[model samples]
Target: MTTRRFFIKTTSLASAALFVKPGALHFKDAHIGLQLYTVRNAMGKDPAGTLAKVASIGYNSVEGATYTGTENFYGLDAKSFAALLKQNGLIMPSSHYRLGEDQENGKDLMGTILHDWDKAVDDAKTAGIKYMVCAWLSPAERGNADHYKLLAERLNKAGETCAKAGIQLCYHNHDFEFTQDNGQLPYDILLSHADKNLVKFELDLYWVNKAGHDPVALFNANPGRFPLWHVKDMDNTPQHAFTEVGNGVIDFKTIFKGADKAGLKYFFVEQDITPGDPFISITKSIDYIKKNLI
Candidate 1:
């Protein structure tokens, strides 16, 4: 029901890459998600309109990116946001969260893992989310090998909280996580120290590849450790930038063949930056995904 006739009139209505051969695969819902940050600007302006457009573009699910500062999903409360999603025939299965830094004043910020963690989890439950990811570590936040060990502990604790809420907790990686410090990779340290039963990894395919590692080999190394993914593609340029799914160099078909091996439960199409109309780029990605990479 990805009809193109609702944005201008409905309240809830509002509103990538690559080349290569078109393959055959059915578009599957829930299995695929669009990380909302790809359209962060538009979302800031009109969450409902953007959601309608997202559904029209054929994405039935999304992973949230906003909640911390505003303590809402694009400025709407959890109940209101969830209703808007349902109105647009979309579901949000996961959301990213920040691990807030401590303040000299002794009061931590609201809407972060270290502060009002329970409230966030409660809101997530109301919004029908099943996974919560520790989004990123700021430059100052990630210092040395010991930093990762502490992070692992935090992730395990956070995972325990999420578990009680019936939600899985995951850590999203950036290329920085792979950089070796004193010959020990932070990513490796994290994977080793974090409680396996409690915390899982949300592998960012682009970043991992950017760090010069083989994802399949990583999957083989830690089977069933990855349940979520950010499926943004890397362009075939010298810069190796972001592009639409099939247009890039990533062999998604072969990568997807290892879905079961990686315990990949969900993945989202994400492009940090787009060259032209973001809508058109996403449409191109959706069309490609329809043909290949189910």
Candidate 2:
């Protein structure tokens, strides 16, 4: 009896070789990738199967999250995982990682820096990922500007390590990064002080808007520093609900036009919460991007 993994491996090769007739499909001038976290339900069930579904949805790449679990990315290890992605016409360009944990306790905080993320960086290299990012800053770490300065120093160290490995260290933002400390935004401070060669940024459009800022303006201010982005949408309603792409208030066309200047190399569609089926939500997002942004 053929095992599930064997069956998947065979089918993946066949899928990669499938042909596209003339004018059958078109990709964006800028490629569009998916963040697997968008379909967390599917991923939690079968990671390889979930990857297959993403490929079926026309995604040529993916961004990973929570890499510590899920049979170490379908039990293939880093090199095998990279091979699997290549077999599926997919590339994993980046991954989200939690910031360092406290040494005194196991919880993540600003109190300590990650001494062992070098191992993770090595694994990322094997998986063909170019960017290692801190996905979120803990509340304690975000408590003040000095805290952010400290975080920036730690990130600089990580970024330097990644630079030596031919990779980049990036910081992903949420709405709180816009919170002011002594009339200065912590995120701005981070951008200003962090080593430019070592540190890059992954701008989340939705959270930037939620923080009452403009994505295009940010791109204009810092040209070519951002190489990754989180593409999510928000409802036009008074409550500003999370909704499917193209059904929300964000103006992606304007943003997509400025991608080159923004230093955007890859972008992933993400939604923190879905009002309905996540699969449907992701499908709609893919369709919207292909139709409008592509």
Candidate 3:
């Protein structure tokens, strides 16, 4: 009767033992991006309008979250999506796509489940996306260290596939990967076992902090492994709920100082749950990032 929440709590306790001192702050001008998932509702309603608003908010880059079974970018074909981004003055460098494990109940019958994978990669290339990320892991896909090992193998294969198409493959982590399984963290297994040349990571800052792990320590342990990041913040509440970037307690300034060490290439602002209008929330977050962190 062990629930995912219980497992997360236990893992938090386990990760608390490993903490490092905050490093010095270093600032650099980097292209600000947004994960389209934050405004998914709006995007679903009007992809063009949503992206236009996002661009008007000063986000020069974006990471897509609407590539599931459609193999299309927000209902638009690859070429059309690319054109739309150009019209909005935005560039898409990366996107989130569910892995094979989380799709079709982990089945691979005649490759129908992932039949659109090649086309997806091709479309991403056409759309100028440099990274194709495995966005999440199903509860069933994560059982133990062995399961993670198998998942890592799948990641490597996926990475190889993307590599052939001139794109990099990355895994996006949630709090679950930070938890331990038989004293071995799934994150460690994926980082240590996954092929470094083919597989990278897109670190979500808020989830890593919630898991009681230090992002700096992770960067120190595995240098140049993280090329992308989800720039979200956490409030001061006991739950550490999502908040606007500068409004939260997370020390993003110190974290960004280690961007070089983390091998950061692009970062996207993503507030999973906002209080009011998502556009206003993102605007405030981006303004804060420009003024303070980035």
Candidates' C-alpha lDDT: 0.82, 0.77, 0.82
Give a tens-digit lDDT track for model 3, residues 1-294. Answer: 976435433433232221222442232324678999999999999999999999888787889987776677888988999999999878899998876544464644221114557777878899999999988877866789998898888889878889998999999999999898889999999998899989999999999999999999999999999999999999999878999999988989889889879988889999999999999999999888755663
RMSD of each: 6.0, 7.3, 11.2
Give one digit per residue, the lDDT tens place, for model 2 in 1-294. Answer: 976435434543343321222322222223457887888778767777888888887677789875642225545678888888887778888988777543225633331237466677888899999988888766655778888888889899888888888999899999999988899998899999898778989999999988899998988999877889999999988988777789899988888777767887778898878988887888899888766664
TM-score of each model, in listed order = 0.88, 0.85, 0.87
TM-score of 2: 0.85
Q: Provide the lDDT at 252 for model 3.
A: 92
* Superposition error at 126 for model 1 (Å): 0.6
- The candidate with the higher TM-score, 1 or 3, is 1
CA deviation > 4 Å runs, candidate 3:
1-29, 102-115
Candidate 1 lDDT over residue span 123-155, tens digit each: 999999999888988786898999889989988
- The clash numbers for all candidates, in the given order, read 9, 0, 0
- Give the residue spans of candidate 1 off by over 4 A: 1-30, 102-107
Which candidate leads the pack in TM-score? Answer: 1
Q: How close to the true structure is residue 3 of candidate 3, measured as C-alpha lDDT?
A: 61
